[model samples]
Target: MATNRSEKTVSVLKIAAFAALTPMLLAGCTSIKDRRGYVMDQALTTAITPGLDNRQSVEGTLGQPSFASQFGDPVYYYVSSTTEQRVFGQPEIEGHEVLKVAFDAAGNVSSVTTAGMDDVRDINPDGDKTPTLGRDRGFLEDLFGNIGAVGAGGMGGGVGGGTNGS
Candidate 1:
């Protein structure tokens, strides 16, 4: 009985140790701050004015930009992304904030503008809401259309329907 008790105690201790250390181990792996350094570097590179120095240079230090325009005046964008992840799962974006800064000919800050969650547009903005081009058919119409020849099965006829008109 005493041996069994000692074994149980040891098992409990191991489980407790794992429970405590699991978060630390996982936190080290999933911490977003580690990944955020690169974004900060990019922002600094694009945002820094050529002639300006110190606070004046960083007056409009934006967080993160979603995109930078490739054409015309070089546009710097700052975007802030919040993501959530579960253990052994993929990370999901929770929120985003964006700022657009345009630099003029001299490379000094020209204009600073900020946009938030509402400013972003969906990739498929009119996905479900947009009306279909053709006459909207009922579910049964679509189902039957899929099963028969005139329903786009082609002139080859259909399964068990025979190739030639007998």
Candidate 2:
């Protein structure tokens, strides 16, 4: 009887242990991770040697950049990021990289730059309202500000005849 009771207690403990750990175990299964944006491989990135690799060579080697600049030498950007989300919460950036390549007028690679999370800057906005060079007024004030500004006077004087009939 004693041995049987001890076995039963052990079984109960095992059940409790597993029950306590079940949530965490199941949570692990729900963790989602995604590798997004420009896929940067070491060998592929190293293959691009500035001054040697032109637009054609670079594109042929690593494909199109994530984006390109609008002006100047037309900088090309390769961005990569890894996001991790648990359950239904917002995804968090686990890794980030910004690779930039500047091309000269001849389309030859002029410079290569790389940035990571370490280079990220935190921006703390001052307030909700955006500051602009204009007078700030309430909604009602704006709605009524131009109400009486324009005169209701119909067209300049007369359009041919008023009292002269000519």
Candidate 3:
């Protein structure tokens, strides 16, 4: 009887210990993310050759680019990234790529370039002031600019702007 009771207590302790640790183990598990643009297949991307693949062919093969340049040269960008976010923490970038395809003025494929995250650059604006051509107004000018612009509401001919037919 003593041996049986000891074994039962040990089993109960083991179960309780597992139950207490189960949540902690699950909490350590993290979520992976395939974000932004779709993942580019190596073979498919390699098949795209500049000067040979035009807009139509490129679209037909690799699909539309993640973004297109708004300025000159008409460049298309294929951006892809994989991120991992931990519990209650900002996501960390695991992989990133920027594929640029330039189109000639004639609308043909001009060149293809591939760059990693190291190529990214942050732009810093030149000055604190935005530089406007208009004249600057003082605080008093702004505060009193609209003074006397409006008259007393009682001077209006119609009280409610409604006319009753006689």
Q: Highest TM-score: give the candidate number.
A: 3
lDDT (Cα, 0-100) at 49 in candidate 3: 88
TM-scores for every predicted model: 0.38, 0.62, 0.66
Candidate whose lDDT is highest: 2
Off by over 4 Å in 3: 2-7, 10-27, 122-166
Output the better candidate (1/3) by lDDT: 3
**Residue 75, candidate 1: how far off, in angstroms?**
3.5
- Lowest-lDDT window of 10 residues in candidate 1? 31-40
Q: Cα miss at 163, model 3 (Å)? A: 12
lDDT of 2 by residue, 1-166 (tens): 9999999999999999999999988977787999999988989888888889999998898789999999777789999999999886899999999999889999999988899999878788787877778888889998898875565556445456666676
Q: Name the 10 consecutive residues with the lowest summed lDDT in model 3.
A: 157-166
**Every candidate's lDDT:** 0.63, 0.88, 0.83
How does model 1 fare in lDDT? 0.63
* Model 2 lDDT on a 0 to 1 scale: 0.88
